[model samples]
Structure formats: C-alpha cells, structure tokens
Target chain A: MSELELQNKKAAAFVSTETIDGEIATLNLGPTHPATHGIFQNILQVDGERILSAEQTVGYIHRAFEKLAERRPYNQIAPITDRLNYCSSPINNMGWHMTVEKLIGAEMPKRVDYMRVIVMELARIADHLVCNSVIGVDTGALTGFTYMFQEREKIYDIYEEICGARLTTNVGRIGGFDRDFNKEFITKLRAFLKEFPKKFDEFGALLERNRIFMDRTIGAGPISAERALSYSFAGPNLRAAGVDYDVRVMKPYSSYQDFDFNIPVGNDGDTYDRFMVRQQEIRESLKIIHQALENMPQGDYHADIPSFYLPPKEEVYSSMEALIYHFKIVMGETPIPQGEVYHSVEGGNGELGYYLVSDGGRTPYRLHFRRPCFIYYQAYPEMITGSLLSDAILTMSSMNVIAGELDA
Target chain B: MSEFATKIKDSILEKYNNTSYELDTYGEHNFICSKNDIHAVVEFLKNEGFIFLTDLTGSHYPESEGAEFQVVYHIHNLAENVRFRLKVDLAQNDLHVPTLTDLFAGANWMERETFDFFGIIFEGHPNLTRILNVDDMDYHPMKKEYALEDETRTDKDDTFFGR
Candidate 1:
C-alpha cells in the first residue's frame, strides 16, 4: 500500500476509462478471449464491470461464402457448406446436397438414406457434447468438460475413420457418401455407443445438482415461446423454449418420419432448459443411430445417373461411355433440369436449409442458406438483458452460437 | 391439417384468387400464394394465429425474362402444431417487398441477409444495415450475377476487385 503503487493503480484505472455518447463507462470483451467461444467482439456499455448494454460486433470471420457459392457449380457448393457449421459439417453438407437433390428430383437409395441418418445423428451427439461441456466450463466446472470432450473425441475418431479428415469433413458426394462404410467404422461407433452413455451420465451427475452451475443457468436467459418463435430461433434453442416444434417431426425431411424418437421440450425456456434439451437429444440421437444401423437397406449408395456422378475408374478405363460420363461430371457440364427447391433439415443447431435455383446450368443461378444460428444470435441481446456479463457466456454456450454458421 | 393453416389458406384463396395472385397448393397445409397477395396473405396468417415466421428465403432463375426470383416464407402455428409456406415472385429489376418485422421480430435479420445476398430491399425495415457484409462493401453477393472474378476478390476492404 505505498503511495506510488496506489497512484499507479489509479492511473491504470483512469487510462481504461472512456466515454461513449457522453456516458463514461465502456469495456471491450474479446476479439480474442477464451470465454467468447469464437472470434467475436462485444462492446459493453458498463457501470463498474456490470454490463448495462452489450453491443455485439461480429463478421471478423465472414468469408463471403454465399458470394463464393454463386460462382461455383451447385455440386461444388458442398465444400462451402463444410465451412458454415464447421463443428457439424456433415449436417450442413447433407442439407445443401438435399436441396440440390430436391431440385433435380434425384432419389437416393434407402441404404444411403439410413447411412445419412446415422452420420447426422452422430454429428448431433458431438455438437451437443460441446454445448453441454462448454456450459460446464463457463459455470466453473472444468472436470465435467474433460469428461465430455473425451466422448466427443471418440465421436471425432469415428468421423475420421468414416472420412479421412476429422473436423471439416466433406464426406458426402452430391448424391451419397463418396465411399461406403466398412465393418471397422461400425465397430468403433458401437464402442462409442457403449462408452458415451457412461460418460454422459457421469457428466450429468456432476453438474445437474451442482449448486453454482444451476444458479448461473436456471433462470439466466428466460425467453417465452412467443419471443423465441418471433426471433426465428430453431433447433434446441427453440425447443428448449417449450415450442415442441422439431422440424424433423413437423416437416419430416430425409425420411426422418420413419424414425421414432421423442422431441424433448423444456417448460421454463431458460439457459438451463437449452442445456437440458441438448443433453436429452444426445440420447435420442443414439437411439436414431441404433435404429438406422439395424434397419439399413441394401442397395446402391449413389444414384444411377452416371452423367451427374462419376463412374468407377475400372469402368472409365474399360468403356468409352464411362469415360465420357466421367469427363462430363468432372467438368460439371451435366445438365440439370431447370427448377427450384427449398430443402430443410433439422440441424443440431436449428433448421439448416438451402434454397437452390437452377437454370439447367452447371452452376447455381442463386443459392440462399437459411442459417439458424444467424437468426438465433441476432436475438442474443434480448436473451441477455438484465443478466450479468458472465451470463452472456453461459447464454451463448447454451444457445450454441457457432460463429461460422451465424456469420454465413 | 390444423384449422389455423387451412382457414388462412382458404380465406386468402377465397378473397384474392384473381389475375394478380395465383394460388397453388404445394401440400395439404402448404399453399404457394402469388407475390401480389403476399402482404395481405401474411397479414391474415399472422392475425389467424399462424404467427411464427420460421424462415424467409429466395431462389433465382437467370433465364426467365422478367420473373426470376421466387421467395418463400415458411410459417408455423405453435397453438395448432401446423406449418405452411407463403411465396412471392419478383422480377429481376424490382426485387423489393414490404418488411415483415412489423409482423415478426425475427424477420429483421432474415430480411437483412436476404438483402445482402439477393440485393432485395425491405421497404420499411427499421435497421437495414448489412449483418454479414461490411458497411463499405457494395455488391449484393448472393445475386446470380455476382461471380468470383479472381483470387484478389476474397479481400473485403480491397473493394476494387472486379472494377
């Protein structure tokens, strides 16, 4: 407590002080901070470290993906989809490809349909793991996060075993998986199925009754059904608000109607509800994966249209027709009949939709992605109102705002 | 079908099935109404308890002479547990529509995104600033005509690309 030390501390505090519209308190919370969950900046109008109003400033990672997709062929848009929700690329890939399929009237085989269901459910589980674990980390329970990340890493291994790359897995071709699943992949997934439940249970027990975590989350960001729907919130965020409107159940795309599972609803519609709904969804996804594996049909993985998809290399070397078809698909010169289709799937986050338009050309005439995160994150301020600054991190993690998907 | 979606679609069809607006039944609950009746139909849908505006998106056809844009609005009714589609068509030059933020708060950012990509303007949007694009950027990136000219086109501040 020397005079020089006290003055230096006072000077440091004074240097940090600034005016915003004549009001003197302001604080910058991350373009680089672990608590941000992603690369995002929030300029907070503050009063003694208590947030008055938080103005979120994003687009630090805006890649202009929609513009990039306009120039590329509709088939090539799969890679761009990979970038949107980089945490769950398979879901985005399948969603974008399904839109194209709907436009062209392309029918995938029943086996491929089952395979897609399995992979997407696995992605859903992984996404929930991160959301749930990060909720724990934000609430100061690092042990719970370690348990969940281990299960998530197992899921990532399965993804890598299925596709060569783990994170940005551009797994699907335009119609179906680029390659068929082997026995080894199935064995690894079954092992994850057995181990995941135990880890999930242990993590749940650790946080569900933890007084501090519950206090932070229970009523932290309570939004009503009216507000949630009006904000265009989707996926777990909307479901957690007691909407009971799962797009899979409401619209039933990709033969999701055939799968039997409950759409878990949360009555309170708070941060705790959002977290709980996602946790419940992990079990539901496991159920879907089990069913999909059991009921998988035996047939071709891709459509029989050789001109649109590549022929086998053996056929290409042996037959002139196969070579010609190969050349056409590679050049993206294969003609698609002119039409438009809006295809949507219940992504782990929300409704991941693609509105595709074609002029019978190689490239998409126009492509618009109805990203759920963008809509949900736009309403972040409304959710965080009257809550402490720390609650912002918990609210974001509960809502699971992936910046890639939100910005795209 | 829930009475909410059915009555709303029937009411619109009964009232505005004229030269300007064409009504096509896409599914049992889903009906594709013409662009002209979009404002009226949306108002009816909102008043009739089909309040949740789930999604608003666009599709473009370059070959079409005047009509190119097909915009769809997916709506839901939480009370009745039903969903429906409302649609409008826009000519290439006049890609403008009334903002739905008055009806649904969620439409604000969705409309801004639609504007950012398709270059369609919402007539009465409160804050119609770019959500994804920087304030300085000019081109509507999602329009059919906006193409990637070169590698330098990736840079956002160097707006001189394609110039």
Candidate 2:
C-alpha cells in the first residue's frame, strides 16, 4: 500500500465501519480506579489501546467547601482550606490567611515573613515528592517511589514539629505562626536540609536518565506553551511548558522577593518535562529555604495584632483583657474591613490562589480557591486524545489532579 | 488609579464605549462591562496582554438591584506581571453572558462551575452542565437564599425553646 493509502486505511479503522476489528470501546478510567488515586471518572472512547476521546465526570468528592466557607469566620476557614490541596495544605492555609490579612491590612513582621517562606517551601517539596514519585510508580519504577516517600515523611515530620499535624497541616495563622519555630523544629529542619539532597538525588539518578522511564514519558501527552497558557495552567505544569510564570517571581507574596532562586523551565509540556521541572523546582525550593533560614529575622514570629492573635490559655484565665481578647479571637469578631482581596502562592503542581470577599460580617461573604489541579485537568482530554492507555494514566499522575481540589 | 491603570482603562474604553471601572474592595482595578459586551471586552483585554485567565468565579447578591448575579474574571499579563479583574453583572431575570471558551479554552470548566454554583447561564457554552454539583440538583447552592442550616433537623426547635 502507498503512504496515503495506509493513512486513509488507519483513519477508516477509527470511524464506525461496522467491523469487529474497527469497534470503538468505552473505558471508564475511574470514579475510584486504583490508578486515579482519587474519586473522579473519565469515560474514555478507545480504539483498542489508543484513546480517541475522554469525557470526565468530577464532583464525586465535592464537599461544598466554598458554601461552607461562607458561614465560617476567617480563622476557622484555614482547616477547610487545608483540604483543597491536601498534598500541600500549609500553602493553602497560608494563602487563605494572607488573603484575609490583605483585607484587614495586617503588616507581617520580617521574621514572620521568613518563617512563612520556610514552611511554604517545605510544603512545596512535600507536594512535589508525591507527584513525581507517583509518576515513577506509574512508569513501573516503584523503588524510586518507595524511597521518595521516606523523604516525604521527613517533610511530614518537620510539619509535625511545627504545626502538630501531618498531611492537612493548617500550619500558620493570619499574620504569622501561632508560636515561634521551636528548637526541635529548627534542628529537624537543619538535619532534613542536610540529608534530603542525597536521597533526592539518588531517586533522580534512578529514573532521570533511565531509558525505560524516558521511553514511557518523553513524548507522551505533550502540550505546547500557547495551549498551556490558554488553558490557564499554573505552577510546575505551566513552567514545564516553558512560560517561566512562577507566582513567587511574577507577584512575590509572603516576602518571597527577599529570597533568590531560579524558575526552572521545560520546553515540551509532557510527562517527562513535567517530572523534570518538578525535580529542578525541588532544588530551587531548597535554595529559597536556605536563603530564608540564613536571613531569618530576630523578632516575633507573628505580628503584633492583639485581636487577631489568640491569647494563651493561662493569660485568658487570669487577665480580664486577655479574656475578652480570647473571646473575640475564638469568635472571630475582629473588625474586618469590608473588602475583596486575592492572593496566590506557588503550590506543588501550580498556583494556588485565594479570592476573598468580606461584608463586615463574622463570616466571609464569598471565597474562591483558584485550584491549579482543577484548571490543569481541563486540558486532560486534549492531551490524551491519541495516547496509549498507559500514557493516559501517566499523564493523569503527572498532572496531579487531586480530587479534593478538583471538586472543591 | 495609577497611570498604567488609566492607560488600560482608556484603551478598553476607546474601543468599547459602554464600559466603566473602579478600584475594587482590595484597591485593585476592576473593569465592569455589560453582559452583552463581556466577550468583546475580554477579547480586548486579551489583546492588551491580559491573556492568562487565572480565575473565573461567580458571586450572588440577591439584594443588589441590577447585579444579583456577578461573574468575576481574574486575568494576568505574564510579560508585564500585571493583573486585571473584569466583572460582568446580570439582572435576576436575564442571567446570561456570552461564554469565554472561544477566547480562553480554560473558561469551559470555569463557566460550568460558575453556572453550577450560582446558576448564571453562560450563553453559547458547548456543554453547560453542572460541574461541581450533582446533575439533578434543583437549586444553585451558593446563592444567599439557600440557608446553610439543614431545615430537616428535629432538635432545637425555636418554637419549643421560646414562644
């Protein structure tokens, strides 16, 4: 057959030709597939191994968190924010707090800003570890994943030291942390910083240049920078497309301007490039953390806002002033100015933003979370249109579409 | 407004006559346009370097006379690192605005999400189905009229506690 004839023949095979060989099969990827790791279904129209089209059904885990946010006070919303991107909850927590602070005009201390940068960067590392290792696991490299989890748990240990919570860490308060970073947190952070690179590099060495890994991901589900920006891709996904649009550099928040770090970029927005960009971003995050810690200011960890800060239990019991302040703090009765503010942070996979609207009430009038996973997942059908089944799964994993954020 | 904001405002107003802008509650630029010209204004903004649509969400204010339903679009210009917010408000009866999917492919899901939450219809959307809500849901849950409390609860009846 001629080249044109073969092309036409393959095109006929995809259409409804009324032959058993040319039959189109419907495959349900998941509302609960083990590969998906979350509760959302993609009804894929397939011709044998390659996917022709995919229609997704999200909202399986929709908790109506936004509507719920409408009834809760500012401080009470952090716990809810933690659930949006569970892999990097501290960033979400801090993003929400910062949005509220922008509304109330709370000036954070330099020390508070540096402390937040430290916690946010650690959360970024933790977020990337789950995503990139899962990419390795999908590519049949489980050992790298298993080892990376150990490093991720060390991050979780650091979180436990600071916030006393592991996964959904509502790490910091509005102006800053509830308490200063204790000696144990500092020591554990120092130790983790020293030891993390060795394990991380080992994991990278296992898969970064491996022939099999590259073969699986190098050309699978590639998206161009124009399409990526049109789809509103953010964070590492957008960076992988070579836009170099990191929120930290584009619009520095939480004193990110004080630190110096590189914004890693990749040419093709494929699974491989996404994985590599995240890998390099982990290094960049470490650099930012080092900068923050080295220049850690010597003063209060949180800002001096009496109403915004919850008083100590001992102080609340003895002093009348502390008692009233504690009541106000617990009730979230600080006189918040009626305003709208939007603040974003560079999250694990992309930009996580919080858009807040207050009506001079105890609760927020409206709150919207610009979840990167939710945005990136919109381009999934286009990305995996003609890819193999395994590559589709790899693309999904590489995108890191957390169901909580997607259905939030 | 800053000189740059005046430039942006004047540029948009130059092409489209019926448009206005003011500093939002956060002291950021918020351009308001009629629902009919939202598509044109957004296209103008896109041409003016506000191409990256960071967010598109809807809000409801039942008491606000003409703006019972408001759709907010947050766009960013990557090159200049500038952010702009565009708002298109619709009355309670005529809750329709042209879909931005043509200009921004990402607006599809966001439009569905806004429609699902606030029931503001996005005209010409390819598939305007409920995104983050169940397909069979009757009411838009984000509207203020839908009380957060579960009305079916048996405990703590106001009549039993008081009069």
Candidate 3:
C-alpha cells in the first residue's frame, strides 16, 4: 500500500484560482537560479507579475578575502585580488601591485606603465564583452552571448600568453610585470585588437538598437544622477547615470594621463544606458590600447628594485645574492615603511580600492578592499522595486555585480 | 596640497579650535578628528563639495592603547578632482560612531561591512546586521585577536613555525 501510494503521488499540487486573492506572494529569486548568474537571493514581495519590494540576501560565497590578506605577504595578496572581480582580474592584480608600489614609493618605467595600460585595457574589454553579451542573454538573445564569448576567449588567450594563466590572472608583480611582453602575447593582442572591433560591432547591432532589446532594457530599473552619487555609484554604472568621475581620468594612475580618451556618459541610468555605456567604453579601451601600443617605449620591463623584484630562477640557484633575494621575496624580509595608503583603479565594474595600514610588518596590519560590486548591489532592491520580474534579472546583469567581488 | 585642500584644513582647524584635530598629509590630506567631532567634520567636508563618499572602512589596532579602532572615510570632490580622508578613533570599550547614511546613501552597506568585520557599531544604521558573514556568528573575524591559523590543527605546531 505504501509503494502504490508513493507511485501515484503527483509531482506538484496546485491551489485553485479561487484561493488566489490580492495577497502578496513572497518569491525567492535565487540561491541557485539560472538568471541570477551568481549566488544572489532576493525575497520579493510580489503582486502577481509586479514586484512590490525585494529584500536581497547576499554573502552566499563569502571567502573572507580581507581577513586572508592580513595573513599573506604583500606579494602573495595579488592572487587574492585576482579572485575579486574575476571577470577582469588583471585590473585587480595591477591595482594591488600599484598599491604596494605607492607604499614603497617605487617608480615604474614608462614601458612598464604602457604595458600595464595595455593589459588593463584588455581586461576592461573582456569585462565589458561579458557584461554586454550577458545582458543580451538575459533579454532572451542567447546567440550574442554564445557568439561573443569566443571573442572574450581570445582576450583570455592573450592573458595566458602573458602569465600562463587565464581567468584569475596574477599577471604583474609589485613594481612591474614579472617579465616583458613576449612576442606571442603581442601578436595575439594585435590579432585580437584587429578582429575585436568588427565582431564587437556586430554584437552591438544585435542588441544595441534592436526593438526587443530596447523595450526590455530602456525604462527598466533606472536611478537618477543625484541618487547614484549619493549611493557612490562608480565606473560605468555611475557614468551611465551622467557623472563623469573616472578614477583613471581623475587620478591618472599608471600613465593613464598620457592617453586621451572620452568618457561615455548616458542620460538615463537605466539598464539600457548601463549596457550602452559599457559598449562605448570597450571602444574607448580599444583606443587607449592602440595609443599605448603605438607609443610603447623602449626600456626595462620592471623597475630595478634590488630588494623587491626577484632574480632569475637559474641565477637563484647559481649565485648567493640571488638566493638571498629570493628568500627576501618569498619570506618578505624587506623593511616596509609604516604608513597608510589608499590606492584605487577603475575596475571592470567600478572603483576597486585597497586601503592598507602598516606597522612596518611583513604583512599588512589591516587591509580593506573597497569592492565596487558590493556598493552597486546594495542599490538593487531600491532599483527593482516596482519593475516586472523579468526586468529585475536584466537589472542585475546590467549592473554587472559579480558575486565573488560582492561577497569578498 | 591644492588651495581648496588647504582651505579645508584651515576651516576645520579654525572651526574645531582643538589640539586633537590633526591634519596629517601621509597619502591624502587626512583630517584626523576625535570620534566626538566626526559627524560635524564629515558634514563640513560634504558641504565643501567633497560629497562623493568613495569608501568607508575600519582598521583594528589592539596594541595601540585607548584607541583600538579607527574608522576611515575617503571622500572625493568630483568637480575639483580633490580627495581627502577623515579619520575618527574610538577606544575598544566603546566602538560606536554616528552613522553617515544621512549624508551618503552608500554609507549604509559600507558601515554594515565595517560593523561585520570590526564590531564598530554605526549608531543610527537602519539595519546594522552582518553583510558578508553569516548571521548569528558571534565573533568579528577582522580584529587582531582572531588569529588566522587553525588553532586545532596538530600538525602545524606554533613552536615549530617560530610563532
């Protein structure tokens, strides 16, 4: 009797429409839903299709990176930065390197600066491609996402040539890169730069002015410019809201001052504007990379810091000074100045800042990562209050909130 | 320092008229004020067009007696392209500070994160719950007291590692 009853049980039992009323249904969007693209859960108070309110519950993938950074040496912390905003990891790695560079008062060569600019811009292009294509995927255009992903893959190939790792790339060292830009890396980058614009324009044509894409994104989940500033919106999201405050342009780190590029601002801070802002930013990044490559200087790849940069591995075993320097690098025996510094770079999503406090120790006394995704995600519930359920998904993707960075 | 930055320092020094307000220029022009004057100082800075609150975080210094925690606020004046730091220190016993959510809407989450990590309570934060860690976890992990190593692991002896 038990077996027969279990076999006869229905998959889902539905309540009759007679029981339905004006009551608000609390809908859980995701701890694991396909549309979320990350581990984000929102308990939504919904009246049928329209969202009355949403209470976002983040921290599903909190790795305690700041806590971990306190224990690791300054050089070891680059890998941890890579995990934050994994979509465009080189920016985080470079930003971390630049932070320590600031702490040590190290000067990078112009060639090193230009190389960093190229890598950072490539990371930005890769990041924007993923964000824009995923926006299309959210609006039911899967073709663009699958098609442009290969182009993103090409950028990762360039990363692989540079550092022998893709995705979470620990590309550069503290003062500068571990090695110069190898020949294959340049060739791949040149090929990518040549091919990226044509294919990227096709991706834009697929979603930029498409009737279906515009309707899904134009009026969905908008924030005013004043409200965006109050919330500390940054990067493309802030630019989409009509504020032209780019850290690269404002602060001008790593020779960003040398390059001339326009910041693409939008009138409405809606999903469409965010997407379009990123699309135009990708083109600007391309322009910056072209300038950096054409004007690439001839000099040493990394700054000549005897105590900082490691000697060649072969020399480490052959020579005594090289061995001592290697130990100094691995164990971090160099005397760090006791100071506090705040260094930020325009990350893929926004201003990724690192605030470090030192007591002249091997590791940071206190370290805080100002992840942009964390700031942008808190504004989600306010953004999607009265929007349709489908529009909420588009809003999340358009905001480009990576869960790794958000919960770090 | 720029003329405006110098003006910010002078105005704050004149307004506060206290020895505790230290305008130190380490990286950015850090206006170090006591916890009592943090609210007024931040409000003053905001009025001077340093309105964008770029980042707000805390650091724990257990060895520093009387001043065990410090909340650092980084604000940027976008038009002028000037940035400044406003620091307020609190003793370990009383780790409460006035909330900046009234001034910057983004301060809500940043303050919650600071609270989650260092147990520095923002007095008027609407929902001052944990943001990055699980709820009901009693200890704040970012404090210096919490060692990152696994105390329970028998293989990695502290004596062997020269701890």
lDDT (10s digit) by residue, model 1, range A1-408: 532254345434533553233443777888888997898788765555444566677777888776677667667888889888888888988888777777777888888888888989998988888888988889888998887888888888888887888888887777888788888888998898888888788888888777877887999878888888888888898889998877788777778878989989997789899988998998899899988888888988887766677788999999999999887777677878786566789887988877665777777766778888888887776666446778877887888888898787
TM-score of chain A of each: 0.92, 0.95, 0.94
Whole-model Cα lDDT of every candidate shown, in order: 0.78, 0.87, 0.88
For model 2, the docking class works out as medium
What is the lDDT, from 0 to 100, of the residue A197 in candidate 2? Answer: 97
- Model 2: colliding residue pairs: A235-A350
**Better candidate number, 1 or 2, judged by DockQ:** 2
Q: Against the true structure, what is each candidate's TM-score?
A: 0.87, 0.95, 0.95
Tens-digit lDDT track of model 3 for A1-408: 221132223101111222235566889999899999999999987767767667889899999898898878899999999899999999999999999989888999999999999999999999998999998989889999998999999999999988999988999998888888889998998998898899888988988889988988998989999999999999999999999889999998999999999999998999999999999999999999999999999999999887889988999999999999988888777778989899999999989999988888888888889999999788887788766899999999999989899998
| Residue-wise C-alpha lDDT for candidate 2, range A229-325, written one tens digit per residue | 9999998888888898988987788888888889889999999999999999899899999999988889998888888888778999999999998
Q: Show model 1 residue runs off by greater than 4 Å.
A: A1-24, B1-7, B17-37, B58-72, B77-96, B150-163
Clashing pairs in 1: none
How would the candidate models be sorted by lDDT, starting from the highest?
3, 2, 1
1 against 3, candidate with superior lDDT: 3
Evaluate chain B of model 1: give its TM-score: 0.77
Alpha carbon lDDT at A385, candidate 1? 46
lDDT of 2 at A335: 81
